[model samples]
Target: MTKTARLYKIERLIRQRQHVSFAGLLAELEVSPATLKRDLEYLRDQLGAPITYDRELNAYRFEATGGGSALARSTARHELPGLWFSERELYALLMAHQLISGLDSQGLLSRHLQPLLDRIHELLGPGGENDSKALMKRVKIIGALRRPVDATCFERVGEALIRRQRIAMRYLTRTRGEVSQREVSPQRLVHYKNTWYLDAWCHQRERLLRFALDAVQEATLTDTRAKDVAMRQVQAEMDTGYGIYAGGTRQLAVLRFSAQAAPWTSHEEWHPEQQGRWLADGSWELTLPYADETELVMDILRQGEQVQVMAPDSLRAAVRRRLAAAAALYVGA
Candidate 1:
């Protein structure tokens, strides 16, 4: 058995019997005398377990009442609170916790997530006991082009979303280089591609729209309740696209990735409804539904010459124009 499991069982056995002999503990834990003694010492010293041996009885038991660290106090006469977890499961939980904690460093979601993180830490046992920091050190998530979410804007948007209320905000559109005041009824907050976006019903446009959380310059909740868009409508309009740029119209976009990029692009999840096939020339052909080509074009351009827009003349033309404009920048230089 693992040391953690053995330690937990040893504590349970001693607590159940109120006083357990060394022979009984050794037999139950299936550990050598010295290993069992070391385990007991760790519990007593490092964990602050109030353990004392009775000379007359020749058995170990709690001090009836002893005070120390929280772990020590809790496990004084009881088992550890955290349920046993396999190494793999513990790693998954630890990675998720770390990812969430990292994203919250800007304080955007800190207030909302503190209680949740605290509960998880408690259930996982103390960081020292679990070696959470060591586990976290082995894993890392890198966001190549990441943006931070605004804390004040996020707080207001989250409150409005939870209450199913409308909010007024000044949002900046990078494409147009304009900041417009809008009153929108928030439907959901989406964190996609390491960015936070708000899917809402735009009062000015009289349609559903997506606004980046970071681009929200100002936000305030309104007394008006939000309009409820059906789940079916939301999925059809928003989820049918390649990325956050969604619309009512949907079209199939075919893309060809060269052999060099195929190794990575073939394994990528570009879209849910995407279909892919390997060509004889060692390239990959991918088909996906898209409503707006804005985000799709950006993804394609990021791959440079390794990707090509195979079909849908409009998308191809758009990409061609963008590449030409970008190439012109180096012409003079």
Candidate 2:
């Protein structure tokens, strides 16, 4: 029998019986003693099966506490253990891997996922050749407003988050031109539009805060344990508002997209709480909740004349001033 088929059979035999003798496996598999020994090792070590030799019984039996046999313990969970995937599933997973790999320029994500990816490639077989690579080349992912992050900072932040420990950081905000030292208990790491953010409990503010990973000048894991904030409070503090700035009162901002921009804006999801309608004039009207107008204004500005802030006098006024300032630059030139 082939190595793969024999391995599967060996697992089935051992699992079905209370104890399986080496001679029994040898006779059934019709393999040499050395080959059977190697197969058993592969099953125990690589597959994480808790197979132990019972010298008293001269047989192998599954240990009470199975180490990591996904196949043997498949019944406990509703998943197959043998790393099996359909061709289409493999393609989808590879595409996802490609998308993430392209966006992970810092190699932080790629480094951790390399093992699983390697296993997938092995499963695809040598016949696939460069299919995965070619498919990756065919797909492209582009990012806007992505910032480079220091490896050490990312590593330290990840460590603190995993250990539920506090992190000391030197953070720089674009609006404030100086670095501020902070001790934060990281609740979760967020990746939005290619930028990394940490939703954390700010020790100084005594409240939850969001810190952009790129703006983190320095980060060090602390010995202190992180203060646990309720999940509901975190959601209320961070997920209720539009975009990343979700800390304040959410205000509804009404926007009108010109007919020229309707094609693009019609399909876009501005926000979960957003309400939109198609106007008779071939234009689109959208209203979304936002805590801060800073990011919203930037997005609208990208559309140039195609978008107009129709309601909330403050937002409308803010957009007008920014546009005027931008237009003034070309006046003298």
Candidate 3:
């Protein structure tokens, strides 16, 4: 039996009988005397279990619950909570672990969550303790496109967000080719397309900005409490538009996908507030609001001739120019 299982069973035996002899524990656990002794010591020292040996009874038992004894006065008895799980529930937990571990490859999240993961393995029943670890081997996470976030920066950013405090950051906006120092109140953290983003109210710009974590050169938590913006306002300004670009939406991009592309485009959620309908001819018509066309335009170009920007001349013209530029590369090839 695994040490955790043995420890759990030992506690239960003691609590049930109110006292259990060492020989009885060896028989029930089928472990060597030395192993049982180690388990008992671990239960006391590591788990804070207030287990004590009674020489008169020649057995082990919990210290009385009341604060009368020295052991009871220092620490209360610890109980290992029951972990009963249906097969399906266990599978779901394992799946969630796999996915979370994939998203958190750096062990940033895994370090804090390892204890809970251990408890999960202990639930595998008896000596099947290795089962969860074996399952972990079978499940693979491919993070080829993942952009690594600095561990220190991520922690400070997360701490400031949870503590409701402002943070100072030296930001590098690659798109603009500029580096600026700013103090911002982190409103939310977004993990989209294999990267982390901080949605914050930029103090310098005095507007909402989505700063990619990869672009944050440095972060320092501040004592000043974060400026709180209502969720409704944040959603309107930050989320209403397509992708990560932020602002109150200025225009809607209406698109029509060919029948072949409709099958896929109709089912995709390009934006939270997007509207889509199937035309009589089996094409898909999608209209979504956007404050900036930068991201929306790239998505359109990927479809090549399979999609068309149906409305708003600006978007159509932009797509045409991109297709023209891309085709120009092959002009003399």
- Candidate 3 residue-wise lDDT, 1-333, digit = tens: 555557778887887677889999999999999989988886777667788888887988887677576545324445655333444465567777877788756866667677777766655543455666677778887876788899899999999989999999999989799999999999999988778899999999898889999889999998899999997888778887778777754898899999999999999999888999999999999998888898899989888888999989988899889889999999979
| Residue range 240-291, candidate 2, lDDT tens digits | 7777787677799999999988988989998887889999999999988998
lDDT of each: 0.80, 0.81, 0.82
Off by over 4 Å in 3: 1-63, 67-79, 82-90
For residues 149-264, could you state the per-residue lDDT of candidate 1 as single tens digits? 77788888989999999999999999999999999999888988788999898999998888899899999998999999986776767787778887757888999999999999
Ranked candidates, highest lDDT first: 3, 2, 1
For model 1, the superposed segments whose C-alpha errors exceed 4 Å read 1-27, 30-81, 84-88, 104-107, 110-130
Clashing pairs in 2: none
Residue 161, model 1, lDDT: 91
Question: Candidate 3, clashing residue pairs?
Answer: none
Off by over 4 Å in 2: 1-82
* lDDT value for model 3: 0.82
Cα deviation of 59, candidate 1, in Å: 12
* Each prediction's RMSD to truth: 6.1, 6.5, 4.9
- What are the models' TM-scores? 0.74, 0.77, 0.76
Q: Local error of candidate 2 at 132, Å?
A: 2.3
> Model 2 reaches what TM-score against the true structure?
0.77
lDDT of 2: 0.81
